[model samples]
Target: MKFGIIGTGTVGTAIAVRLVEAGYQCLGVETRSARSYARFRQYLNRDRMPLESWVPEADLIFITTQDGMIGSAAKNLADRKLYKDGQIWIHCSGSQKAQILKEDPALPVKTLSMHPIQTFADVGEALKLLPGSHFGLEGEAVEEGIQIVWDLGGIPHRLDPEGKPLYHAGSVMASNYIVALADMAVQLFNLAGIPKEAALESLIPLMQGTLRNLEKVGLPQALTGPIARGDSEVVRSHLECIPLELQQAYRALGRSTLELAQAKMKLNGKEYPRQDLQILNYLLDGGKEKNNHGNCRENIRSKRNYC
Candidate 1:
């Protein structure tokens, strides 16, 4: 496909590199600065043309701008009457839907939203992480988008348009919140007299090993630690030691972890007695148990059984 990249940012540059390496023709790029334009020019080894000039020539165009600007860029293209029938317009937005590209339905162009599930710390990181990563896709041209993902050696997963918020929330939890979690870990390390500088170095192996476990056994089977063992005393002790600001987060995560632990027990054919799980739940939820024991019981029972 002859592709044109709009906005030569980290994502756009990484994608452009992949496209050219995969033997796709990058017609040109539209960038905000001379530096960005020059950078993409070297990567594409082609002229950096204006958006209106290139949009008409390419079979596929990537609006790889910020989530907020993607709609405006597409609308600008429509205003210039550049969209052509049968052309595909793609954006790597986790939050926005494909409809963002259809600023003018008169053009009959196809819009596709293909978001990488992995984080891109930079263009280099993006290139390294994008391959073998999963792409959350939502669009009319899903098959076309999937082919593009495959070309980049990424796995494509379809997403419902209505569930965009929830889907992106999963991404935020997985990618963005890891930093928050690392910060929390660093604070605890500091309490133990471990320097903040060394905290991540010490923790990285543990995190990597946990990730490997998840890949090897998948969820429920991969679960471990205090909640998995149905150890209420340990859980309570952790709640006591963790900082006050993190208490609610700890509890919320603990409640969900308990569910996973319950499933693990069932899957492994080692039943955790309901009373033991109940004790852990009571500790995690605190006053919620007092307020509505029946509702809490219903909530626990309503959770999926992995076995």
Candidate 2:
């Protein structure tokens, strides 16, 4: 199949090169920046062509533009009548639905959103990470998208269009939040008198172990530490030592962890002692409304089988 790309950014260049290596014909790339096109040509070894020269001829076209520009790019191509009938148009925006490309009903093209569920720092990183990565597929051309992803050695998952935002949010939470979490851990280590330089280094193995656990055992089972152990005292000490602003995040995560802990306990045919569970809830809930025992019990009891 002949394929062309509209944006020659990191993702666009990577996809183009990989597709070519996988035996797809390159109709060439179209981009606004000279530097980006230069980089694309450096790896792709293909000519930079005008949109009119390639878009109508390619059987598949990827609009791998920045998330914000995808809609406008698709609209422009549709408006200029560059897309031919039955051609497949795709975007790699995690948060956008395929309908963004089908704004004109009479366009006669198949629209698809195929987002890689992996992070790429550059074209090289993207090329290395694209294979064996999962791609979220949504739109009228889902079957075609799956075939293309498989051809690129990627796993494809069909997703509900309405859930695209939530799906992207989960991806961001897993990718971006890991960095934020590491920073937070390093800060806490600094507060604990660990040298700033040594904080992240020390934390890396611990984080890696946790990731290994997740990979090996999966959720609830993989969860560990004070919250997972129902150690209300340890949690309370953490809140007391952690700065107030940081405590808000700690407490929020504690509550979520508490839910997982409860699930783990149930899975093991165990349960938290009533008082321990209540105290854990109270601490994680910020000890707010001290007199609202009924509210606390209702909330906890409603969500936990052990309660």
Candidate 1 residue-wise lDDT at 186: 80
Error of 1 at 301 (Å): 40
Which candidate leads the pack in TM-score? 2
TM-score per model over all chains: 0.89, 0.92
Model 1 residue 304 CA deviation (Å) reads 43
Kindly report which residue stretches of model 1 are placed more than 4 angstroms away from their true locations once superposed.
287-307
User: Which residue runs of candidate 2 sit more than 4 Å off their true CA positions?
Assistant: 288-307
Clashing pairs in 2: none
What RMSD, rounded to one decimal, does every model reach?
8.0, 7.3
Q: Which digits, one per residue and each the tens of the lDDT, describe model 1 over residues 201-291?
A: 9998988999999999999888889899988767766655555677788899898998888888888888777787777878888633232
Which run of 10 residues does model 2 get worst, by summed lDDT? Answer: 298-307
Q: Report every candidate's CA lDDT.
A: 0.82, 0.87
Q: What lDDT tens digits, residue by residue, belong to model 2 across residues 1-307?
A: 9999988899888888888889999986888989998898789788776789888889998998888888899999988989888999999999989999878878899999999999999989999999999999999999999999998899999999999889999999999999998999888777666877799999999999999999999988999998888887777666655656678888888889999999999999999999989999998888843232333334333533111
